[model samples]
Target: MRLSRSFLPTLKENPAEAQITSHRLMLRAGLIRQTSAGIYAWLPAGLKVLRNIANIVRAEQDAIGAQEMLMPTLQSSELWKRSGRYDAYGPEMLRIRDRHERDLLYGPTNEEMVTDLFGQVVKSYRELPQVLYHVQWKFRDEVRPRFGVMRGREFYMKDAYSFDVDYDAAVDSYRRMMLAYLRTFQRLGVKAIPMVADTGPIGGELSHEFLVLAPTGESGVFFDGAFEEQDWLSEAVDISDRESLAKFFARMTSFYAATDEKHDEAQWAKVPPERRREGRGIEVGHIFHFGRKYTESMDISVSGPDGAPLYPEMGSYGIGVSRLVAAIIEASHDEQGIIWPQSVAPFAAVIINLKNGDAQCDEICERLYAAAPEHLLYDDRGERAGVKFADADLMGHPWQVIVGPRGAKAGIVEVKNRASGERSEMPVDAVLAHIGVGA
Candidate 1:
């Protein structure tokens, strides 16, 4: 991607409306643009990051045996009505009417719809345990939507529904998702503490919210420091075995972590002083085991092994895909701009041509771009070196390969680490090796 030819519209000054670091940096770095109060137009660079985050979320969910599928954004109001929530959901539910005067709604969540669909397909306990998920756009009418994507009216979300024949099986499904969420955030380079949280409108007996710590987070959170050392992917869990699943669930739940709403002073005191970690946090994901809440309300039933009618216990897991873009920025940005993790970085690196018109500089830049053009952003614009450096820092490329006239002539280039600000001049081949790029 050539900088001059790209559609990136970076701002020189911060927008007055951006009250948070992620919001300001997102705008200044040309990642997103506000189309309305809380709705945004994800530009090319922004969309790339969005897709990368979604892909990671998808992969983690898939690893846990969740099947990916597509769910519509618009839904029948009748579905909510069947679940006894159409009226209860209130103003946040965007109610509408089709040309035929039938009631419709922009779905905020898919609980009722998924319940109805699953009930129609699976009639017996043999299909008891099933998990389905989708990455889709959702709309909820917030009275005062603010803080960029964090509290937006329209957002991208990954919602998964799990159905099981009984309570124990349903709990196992919830714990599996909790493990998946930990691994997902670990890969994304964020520390998201799993905190006990309220079920709210989802109406569940058990719930956990994955919150990423940031100075400007909306929720106050407390957790044990042991959460910091967990390697979720490496921790082996035998989900097929009931005892193993129970043990895994115990390990995850042993930590003292809770949001403000669920914080218990007596329980919090039990944690050793040295192990206590307190901070404000932004919720990135949530998992709920609501049992037969939806199934009972919607009259969804399946036959047991004995041919007895039974309501499948259910759980719902959600990851705010679009909001994570903002949450990641909040958790990992410096004053310059966003410090993106390699797993979800839009581009692996950016090559800045200090002398764009100079033959030597252009040759080096083009060569690097040719190696992996899709993963590299080349600054070929007629801009000042300072401007190029500033923009590269603001955009938060992991590595910046600088090709000035002097280094280009010497068949060498300067490579700078975006996070560490470490600079080194090396042979072009060495530069390629350092950036993990090649011919």
Candidate 2:
């Protein structure tokens, strides 16, 4: 991952078309490039960050017993027709025709397709409860797509479908998935408040949208600061027990959090003055409890204990996998560039050879870079020290290991924290220990 050899095409000036902080920084930092309006080609660094976010989402979903599977990007229009949404979905859906003149579509969402697939199997109540998920690319024909990946027409997404035998069981699954979303955002080093939200085209009565607060966010947000104090991973809530899930859901909803569209003045006044938190927010994830919306529309059913046909209650959970990259930047960046969380940073640290050709400096950087080649980016380019410093800050690795000639000669190096802007000289061994590189 040498900077000189890497395909990172960082720009000195911001792209004029970038209207948002994340969009401008993403372009100038060389994370992504626009191939067309509202579409992008993720570069090496960007793809790595994308994969890291997806991995965190996958791990959290897996922890909650969701089975992972892959679904096609293209789907038969009949799937939507059977669900009675073929004409209702509108222009955002990309309607297409194959050579055979069959009506098809690029799926904007997978509710109908998943319902049909699940119905094809599991004919009895014994297979009543199931959670299936997939991380894949999705396309939507946004009329005015902008804001980089934040509102891209083509993006990566993680969508999960849950099937249960009844309304109560579906509610439990919804609550469980909500807890998982909290854990997922926490692991990604972002505070996302779950607010009651409209289901939109997903057509669910119960819904929650997770919003990450940022000054450049599109939605006005109101919330209680108590959400910042929650440690969902440490909380003892058993998803297997119905009572426990209900209590967990109650505790989560107890916080007064909402976007301007759903804000209630009475609820806001109930919070302590000092604990009130108001800001703008960007949506990163959403979950829905639609009960039998899809199952009933598509005529999907299972056998009940009494030998009667029963429509399975269902829910869908979604995380904007690609949009999160921009959202994280929006929430965390400073004037210099993106301050990536360690969990989702493309590289854990960048090793800057202040004097690239200097024997001592080269020796130190190469040694450190060799220790974790996959996780470290070595700035071995023959660039000025100031240039290297600026680029390191722009790229926003969690840490920057500075190997200047002065320190390199003494078998020491200066370690700088990207977020705190703190630099301290430490022995070579101490540097490895601080960066979690060796041992």
Candidate that scores best on lDDT: 2
Per-candidate RMSD, Å:
1.3, 1.3
Model 2 scores worst on lDDT over the 10 consecutive residues at 226-235
Residue range 96-148, candidate 2, lDDT tens digits: 99999999999999998898889887899898799999999999999999999
Per-model CA lDDT versus the true structure: 0.90, 0.92
Which ranges in model 1 have alpha carbons more than 4 Å from their true place? 437-439
How well does candidate 2 score on lDDT at residue 22? 94
RMSD of 1: 1.3
How far residue 92's Cα lies from its native spot in candidate 1, in Å, is 0.7
Off by over 4 Å in 2: 272-274
Which tens-of-lDDT digit does each residue in 168-260 have in candidate 1?
889889988888898888888888888999999999899999999998899999898987787655768876777877888787788889999
